[model samples]
Target: MEHSHTADWWKKSTVYQVYPKSFKDTTGSGEGDIRGLIEKLDYLQGLGIDIIWLQPVYVSPQNDNGYDVADYCEINPEYGTMADFDELAAEVRRRNMHLMLDIVVNHSSTEHRWFQEAKQSRNNPYRDYYIWKDPAPGGGVPNNWQSKFGGPAWQYDEATGQYFLTLFDKTQADLNWENPAVREEVVKLMTFWAEKGVSGFRLDVINLISKDQNFPDDDGSARPGDGRKFYTDGPRVHEYMKELNRRIFKPYNLVTVGEMSSTSLENCILYSNPEQNELSMTFNFHHLKVDYPNGQKWELMPYDFEQLKSLLSRWQTGMQEGCGWNALFFNNHDQPRALSRFTDDSEYRVESAKLLATTLHGLQGTPYVFQGEEIGLPNPKWNGIEEMRDVESHNIYRILQEQGKSPEEAFNIIRERSRDNSRTPMLWDSTPNAGFTSGTPWIKVDERYPEINVERQLHDPDSVYHHYKKLIGLRKKHQILIDGTFVRLDEAHPQVFAYSRVKGQEAVVVVSNFSKEQTVFQFADAFAEEWLEAGPAELLAGNTKQVPPLWKEMALSPFASYMWLIRRK
Candidate 1:
């Protein structure tokens, strides 16, 4: 199917995600604030970023690191005041860059006014704003469902003697989408930001907004008994998304991406297909789970090369065939850094990081650059649980211990898979606190900041940051990168991830060696006869300074990556 979103600026743009807590701290508050981000607008623009995707800065009670928003309309004191936010929005526009806000409406922190008042009495007007149910006849939780973060999905309200659903942390009460009032509230909050010049909305766990009204128990089919099947891509999810688009996005002409949890490819296509009018793109975690043994995130294994290649190819082809868009990324606030997870941090950090950039950037999707990702940052080396501050990590660590894992064993897993791996402070310079804050940082900065800081990379032309910049720039220069039909090259190639994007006479070919050993790739019969003829092709980008010309048989060095643009002459 031919996609028609070519005219959309977002289609050709790159997004830079800034986790406010660890980005930078100008106020010595020990946490990053709006003003701190404002100070980095030039830095972002210099990196050729087209949009800035800022994580939630809404009022919260320090739960889920601001994902559990207590107030959607107000800026968190820890982040900054509304005035600071306004300055940020204005500064973003001044630089000709768009700002995308993270919208967390699936659940509200228990400290929110609606949830607080709802707890006051069952008859409170705000009671229906959240999901609540009567205790089971056996006087336990409402169902056998478990929270995504471990523990029962329902928390008994002592005052009301009823159970409330919390798909995540107990402090985060799932919003009741069955109530029109709640939906309206969400629209109002989004409109509030749109009115203030926010051009994009990154909806967190958006697919989970519509849950099954029946509140059924898990049948042991879904993994971990999370009851995700009942709510994930639920019966009314499409309707809810359509309603949201009609009320907020369509009117404002804003770009939107839905974070889909445990979602399927078919559901994602419907959610992001332009004709569906639901979302501009969707973020799915299937590829990121290649290392999850048996799809369990708490457990870890060496990433399956075959699975990673297959998943990427499937999503690329599936989304293209369905005219859907993807929000391409490897590292995000909730994920561990891709460098550490995919390649050896000691030997091939820079090359593999660039290899990953070229591999994903050449695909038909909008790429997102997590703050430290462009600088080739890897997972922090934590001494113990004390240095790791992620709430989920702490919870998982304790659970692993209860399951009979020794502290050392559990810590190793946590060290590798903890969300804190990506949440570490952005390394700006090698000075104290990695130049993130003058005061003691809320969390310890990664010890490798001295070598990986942006300052060091900025001056080096061969740095990973420059490689990302070149890859991003190519997206704008080559329309094939955005609108071309995706075709995976040598789908079963053991050590190399390769693909080609074709659009009429022009094609962008990308190849990356995912292994430390050298690998040779042979062009397919069709591609070799059509494009690999003895002709001149522009080498658009490569991880190494010296790259060989295109040929029928290509040899890729360890962690090597190259993107070539060819046209019928």
Candidate 2:
């Protein structure tokens, strides 16, 4: 497993994901822009971020919030111009940091040139660029595939008298990867950015590109169907990924991470394994779905802690054994702030935030910190459906009511589990509009911004922001943390989440109390005896004001977390 200069840097680096729309509004447009991000570069660098993973700022119809890219080569006028992007790339390099752009190649917005031309006529040269099929013998949709948002996955094009595949929104047409021209077009666009000095790419839904050409109908057994099985991690996904690597990634020495949706652990390993020449890392949503009762996202229930522990342990151990890398994250643009979902965010907001940080940063992967997560931003409070901006949340609210749920019942579920929760304006100060905008904001700022803004936390010594800073710095200070063997500690422990990362003689043990009450942590029998009787350990980072006793058996306060650097006797 030899490493190149580019390969070694990503392993030791931490990425900060910015949802450009809600990050900062510079022109009083109520939308974040490239200039606004430029103004905050110093703030991000102060937090010790190595790479800035900017979410889609490409030209789009905003159907899926920029996930449906209309033009891969042009910057959205809503965000800024191409010159602003060039300045951002140059500024990022000036600060000795890298910029990673989010790329959506799995599908293209209906307004994209290719899709527009394809819809003009069946014999159009660009028609083969997207997947289009004739009606089934029954004279309906080409297949029984269902849309992820709602309704049918295939949208009928009257002009062509055919239906096109769209697993997500109908406005987003799936690209035909079987066509070499389509694959070549993707490579060309990605290379365009690479030539502009972009260091990496966060590929969105990349696993679904090389879908089954057979276009088979799905059985009704799977919960998330109309036909995810046929497309997710499809037959030629690995082959396509390998080709991508050879075409651009390897030659340009760019860092790439694939956003895998409804994918398997085995597929992820092959997708990210260095030996496989596919990608640098992968993002899986298994652990995040612990609250999805019976794999249903709309329903609500207490998240299964045991299930969370098992899934994390499985991936940690499995990825480590397979020599594959993972992109570790919790809060993101598409999900609610994890603090609200995992623990008590009311009484112990700061403590629980730090605890979640320790739990993730100590794992074996490149940690991605979403905007405002560093300052302990929880989910926003919404009043009604009018305040909601996410299309998925609105669609689900209607579906819940269609399922016979009362208005109150449906809204309650949406309030708890809406993507809009994380899309609120980033709180920079305690001023009006949370200092995010001077004009009317696209979305309302959370009322709690006055208390949880970054200005207040910046001066506080014991703040979530500083905790994340120290954790990011620790990776550079300790080599063991970069490539340690992940060992789960006491999987049966009900109240605490713990693990150890060992490399040769040194190991870093991370212990976190996930419960509200104080708990005791006893070393599991599987732990090596040498570590228990080891010499005095150094406290690496922790959430508590005062350090706890360094011993095999110790008391852990509510939401208490600590990382200890140890050397086996």
TM per candidate: 0.98, 0.98
How accurate locally is residue 34 in candidate 1, as Cα lDDT from 0 to 100? 91
TM-score for candidate 2, please give it. Answer: 0.98
How would you encode candidate 1's per-residue C-alpha lDDT over 239-299 as one tens digit per residue? 9999998988888888899999989999999999999989999999999999998888888
Once fitted onto the true fold, the runs of candidate 2 whose alpha carbons sit more than 4 angstroms away are 1-6, 525-528
- Candidate lDDT scores, in order, read 0.90, 0.91
Consecutive 10-residue window with the lowest summed lDDT within model 2: 1-10
Q: Of the candidates shown, which would achieve the greatest lDDT relative to the real structure? A: 2
